[model samples]
Target: MTWRLVRYELAMIRRNRHAWWTLLTLAALALLSFANLSLEAARANADKREVAAAERERWLGQGEKDPHSAAHYSIFAFKLSPTLATLDSGIEPFVGQSVWLEAHHQNDMLDRPQQKASLLQRAGLASPAGLILTFAPLVAFLLAFVAVAQDRERGTMRLALGASAHPRTIVRAKTLAIWGGMAALLVLPLAALALMVAAIGGRLDTDILLRVMAWTVLMSAYLALLAGIGIVVSLRAPNARIALVLLFALWIAMALVLPRTASSAVDALRPLPSSQAVRQQMLDEAAAYWTAEDTKRHQAQLLARYGVARLEDIPNARMAELDMVERHSHQVFDRVLGALYGRVADQDRLFSGLGFLSPTVAAQSLSASVAGSDFSHHHHFIVSAERYRRDLVNAMNADGMAHRADSNERHINDVRLWSAIPEFTYPEPTLGGTSGTAIPALVALALWLLAVTFLVDRAARRLMP
Candidate 1:
């Protein structure tokens, strides 16, 4: 009986031209956005490879020079776009894609795409993820807002209530039918895209497939929550007009207003220092701590270690001083940069916590994390780059110490030493490692679904014509 009623509701929905048009329009937008992003990601990855190769060539071909000078002529580490970057560009547009890994400083990533974007692209919704988050809820509400209210207005809901033993059963059937339609609208194109990618020889590895599954599940739940809310509101409203007004108001609050407000509130609460300030702080502290006295003390230790009477008597004194400077500067970078990263994490946590109020926030957070375009993913690349820089500098210093002459001769190294430093490779982010943001987002979505389900059930029990 329930299935029969669901079929009936679905049939009625199928006959509604408006619903079909909305679904088709949204699907078109999603696919177009997906295709555009996929192409952009492909181009970006190709460019990254080409630039990285050129940088390596430049580094290796610079011929024999001092190892210390070679360290300063370091290569730039470019970040490759993840496979799922097409699904959600996330923070990738705002955050730069490459970092210079030279000695004595940890540089921030450069080449932000947002700087080159036009006003229209910046202000409007342009990505697949944005389309889904903003429009999918509207579509769900549009379809389900008139579910019970229109039936009541046309004098058929009373007939529906009398046909079923309990009002909840009829309501449940309608809700399922509406949510099922939304699920189809959401999942079908995604499935088609996956198959298309596979047909084109794109590798959907286990991890990528798992991320896709998780993304689909989360988006489905979010759409279901919206559908259920629409039906519940429709059941409680006096008529279809009132139902739509209420649903549109709710949509505006959730989809448009609350997200921006929450972001502003987070910034107000945990504001981060500017890049200039951070750099100056690092330089100031490093200079204050590594004074001439500290350098003299380090020289004394180096001489004592080498069983020499003076700094000049110590073998490779220049390399020893360079090594000491690099080691001490590491402490300053950790202290200053660590604070900056902590604030970023705090802001992220605060924003995620705001998801309790807006499911859009939770959905977006989860989407970005799964797509590997979130700040956490970018942060991992930066940390890795810094580690690589340290290793490269340390390797240069080690070579200088091993080969420099005692007569204050200029020590030169060839391509052999430059090629010794391994090329930077960004490690892939695992689901477990990125769960910091994803887990919180998942929890928020679950709570929203659970709370909405309870409201839906209560509305079902009190459902009237």
Candidate 2:
């Protein structure tokens, strides 16, 4: 009987011309956006490779330069986009794609797309994930908001109840039908587009396939929850008109207002210092720590360690001072920059907590984490690049120390030392690392679905003809 009712509801939806048009329009929009973003990701990745190769050649071609000069002439580390970035760009556009790994100073990443975007592009653009989060709920409301109210208005609901149809069963069947229709219309189309984007970007792999599956399942659950909410609101509303208005208002609050408000609140609660301010702070600390007195103290320590009475007696004593300064700068960066990054993590956690109020927050968090475009993934690349820079600079200093030269002489090295430093390759973002953020979001989504399902069942028991 439930199966029959579900089939009947699905047939009604199939016959609704307006619903079909809306779903088709949504699918078309998603596909177009998917294609655009996928091409962009492909281009960005290609640029990353090209730049990396050119940078390497440039470094190696710098013939017979001082090791310190080579360190100063450091390479740029460009982060390649993950395949899933085509689906949800997350923070990629706002954050720069590449960092300059130079000596004595950690340079900011450059080439932020947002800075280059035109007004029209900024205002009109929507990602596949953005469309799903904003428009899919509206579509779900359109599909299910009148399911029971129209029946009750036309007297068929009373007829069915009098003819021995269970209200809970009817409600459950309608919920299933609504969820199935939504998944078929929105989820399946977007999932297909995501896979196509990955393939076109030449990154279709086992991990990507698994991530796509997880994305599909997550979206399906979200749709189900929305469908249940729409159905319950229809069941309880006094009339179809009231149900439509209430559902539309609910959609506005959930999809538009809450997310923006939550973000603003998070920013207000934990404001981060600007990048320039942080950089200046690091420079000031370095300046204060590398004073003349400190350098003299460091030189004395080196002399004592080498069992030499005078600075002239120590070989490569200047290299030792430079090395000590480099090491001290590392501590300064950690103390200042580390605090800034810690605040970002705190903000993310606070935003995740806001997921209880809006499922969009939870959905976005999970999507970005799976896509490897989240701040955590970006931070990992940064940490790795910094470590490489440290190794490169230290290696250069060590080379200068090893080559026995007079205090007045400069140590010049060839391509061998430059070639000795390994290229910077970012580690793949694992599911395990994402689990810390993803698990909380998954739980939030589950709690929301379960809560809405319970509401639907309870409302159905009191559902009037």
Candidate 3:
């Protein structure tokens, strides 16, 4: 009987010309979005590799210069997007995509896509993920808000109940029917997305498969939650119009308002200091710590270690001194930057705490984390880049100290030394380390699912003829 009822509901939707039109339009959008994603991801990946290669060539091609001067003219650390990140950029667009690894100054990410995009694109409707997060629920709500209420108004609900189908059975069938329609709507679009990825030579590896599965699960949960909410509201409301108003209100609260408000609340609760102030402090402290007297002491110590009595007696006197300066800068940068990052992390935790009120937050959080585009993902890139910068600087300095003999007519280091430092490589993120954020979000989504189910069950039991 439940299956029969579910099928009957689905048949009604299939017969609705407007519903078919909406589904067709959504499929078109999804196809276009995924195609763009595949093409852009391929293009972006190629551009990053080209830029990195150019930088490497420039570094190797440079003529005679001091190693320390070369260190000051550092390479840029590019934040390359994961192939799947094109599906949902999460916080990537708003944040910096590259940072200069030059001496004496630690840079935040530069070239935020937000800065380059139009005002319209910044309005949140520019991406398909935005469309899904903001509009899919509305589509579900509109379909299901009248499912039970209108049936009750027309007396078919009583007919079904009097025919020995319990309220629970009928309500469950209605919910299933609505979600099934959404699945039908998604079938073609999802298939097209797969074809698009293949067309662009994107691999369907284990990680990509897992990521796609995770996305599917979250999106299904989201739609099911919305469908259930709509049905519950419909079951209890006196009429269809009021039922829609109530469902729309719920959607707005969860999707639009909470996400924006949570971030604002976090910033207000724990404000971080300005980057310029911290940077200036680091520079001043470094200058104070590496003064002329300190340099004399350091150089004397280097000469003593090498068993030489004169300043020029040691082959790498300046090399050792520059290394000392860099070591000092690393300590200062770590302490100062560590404190600020802690504040940013606190803000993130506070926002996660607010996830208890909105499943959309939880879904989006897990979605981005799974895609490796979250704050943590970007943080790992920055830290890795900084480590590379430090190692690269130390390596060149060490080479200079050992090999820069006054008698070597080639007074300047050449390509051999320049190419000796290995290229910087970023490691992939392990999801096992994502427990910090993932656990909280997963729990929140579970709780919301339980809440939605409980409400639906209660409404089912309370239904009247």
Model 2's alpha-carbon lDDT is: 0.81
After best superposition, candidate 1 residue 242: deviation in angstroms? 1.4
Q: What are the lDDT figures for the candidates, one per model?
A: 0.81, 0.81, 0.74
- lDDT by residue (tens digit), candidate 2, 352-376: 7788888888887877777777788
Model 1 CA deviation exceeding 4 Å by range: 191-203, 287-301, 304-307
Candidate 3 clash pair list:
none
Worst 10 residues of 3 by lDDT: 403-412
Using lDDT as the measure, name the better of candidate 2 and candidate 3. Answer: 2
Residues 1-465, model 1: lDDT tens digits:
889888888888777889868877887888887887777777888899999999989999999998988988888999887667777778888988899987788888899878877663485366777888888878888888656777788878788667654788888888888888877876657745854663464556777777778778877888889888888888888778998899889899999999899889999999999999998998887663467887787788788778888766766888887777788789989989988988898888788888998999888888888877788888888888899999999999889888755645858999998988788887677765753855777789899999999999999878754
Off by over 4 Å in 2: 118-125, 199-202, 288-294, 304-307
Candidate 1 residue 359 Cα shift, in angstroms, is: 1.2
Cα shift from native, residue 400, model 1 (Å): 0.6
- Candidate 2 residue 123 C-alpha distance from true site, Å: 5.3
